[model samples]
Target: MVTSARPQFTAFIGQQLLASGPLAEVAIAVMNASRNPAAPPIIMFADASGQPIDLDLRGTERDVVARLPQPAPDREAATEEASTEPRGRGRPKLGVVAREVTLLPRHWEWLGSQPGGASVALRKLVEEARRANGDADRARAARDAAYRFMSVMAGNLAGFEEASRALFADDRRRFVSLIAGWPDDIRDHVVKLAFSDRAEP
Candidate 1:
């Protein structure tokens, strides 16, 4: 628990009829009077109507205590939970390494549009995206890796399917990359189709 004596900021509504002076000046004066030397520094602002506000600064002992957020018992627990929460994991896990990445608005929106849903496991989503948008090299490698994928990780196929679906749903990069990597055999099949249509004519 962080138990540091510090000043805080706060505000109060002022009644216009009692307006004996400038509201901003009154707020600053109150804050100055309320601030504790031993506590942290605090800056307060006026309400929309411009009135005197009260803020509580912590730890310093003084005749006038600012109305700062008081130290509560559960505060420690809440802070612990917040500090330990993983960045993008959506929740905390014991042994997992959590990493942070910034996504554009469209990426988030697309993720939200996936079928099995957004709350779906991110690992699956990421792998799916990797697979769906996999390059021709990846496709060839994946085809080559098919034996391994089947042999070593067939048990995880269901997970692969779901993630692949999400990734493919909106991936243009992988879409272009993987198609560009089509194997010779698949490329030949397309050539064969064109020749067959001409031959039929």
Candidate 2:
């Protein structure tokens, strides 16, 4: 999926890629394509999750764009507002949520002895775990996203099952070989989604 301030989408007519960009542009392309009586079915996909996107392309380009979901609130502005808010009598609002932890006695003792007590210690531990597993997590997400798109677009193609197995096995070479005979656009897009985080070998 796309990683940017604005999400991106891709539209394909059969195995031919029609458009790839921000939602408005893709939606406009789809709208235009739909006008052709002989045009094949158009499928749109959200780049981030590789999920199919159903567009409301019934009206003008302007109407289609207007129907798109609104962008999320500006995070920078929200952070600024939160920082400038007046503090109450209690601890400063650090956006910390209180949740119960069910740890053994020894675990609690160790956390209690940490420099910043249980909460800080727990946060630190969680952060460390995330850092350690970050690459694996990202790779897994990419694999899943690619699989989702492949299931929709290439499920009936030759070697689809083998390609899927190779994908989950993290065998890039095998996956590529398995899908070598598929349509160019579909193969290329699958590779892009499955290995966006990795350098080309």
* TM-scores, each model vs. reference: 0.17, 0.77
Candidate 1 deviant stretches above 4 angstroms: 1-94, 115-121, 129-201
lDDT of 1 by residue, 1-201 (tens): 544223222322221111123333444445554454554333233212112244443344352244333432453354466557655553443234456757898877877787645544465676588657655434333233222222222224333443333233534344333333334332222222212222221
- The local distance difference test score of model 1 is 0.37
lDDT of 2 at 196: 84
CA lDDT of each prediction against the hidden true structure: 0.37, 0.85
Candidate 1 Cα deviation (angstroms), residue 87:
17
How many clashing residue pairs appear in each of the predictions shown? 12, 2
Task: Report the Cα lDDT for candidate 2.
Answer: 0.85
Best by lDDT: 2
Residue 89, model 2: lDDT of 38
Residue-pair clashes, model 1: 12
lDDT of 2 by residue, 13-72 (tens): 989999999999999999999899999989999877899989789878888999998765
For candidate 1, the C-alpha RMSD (Å) to the true structure equals 28.0
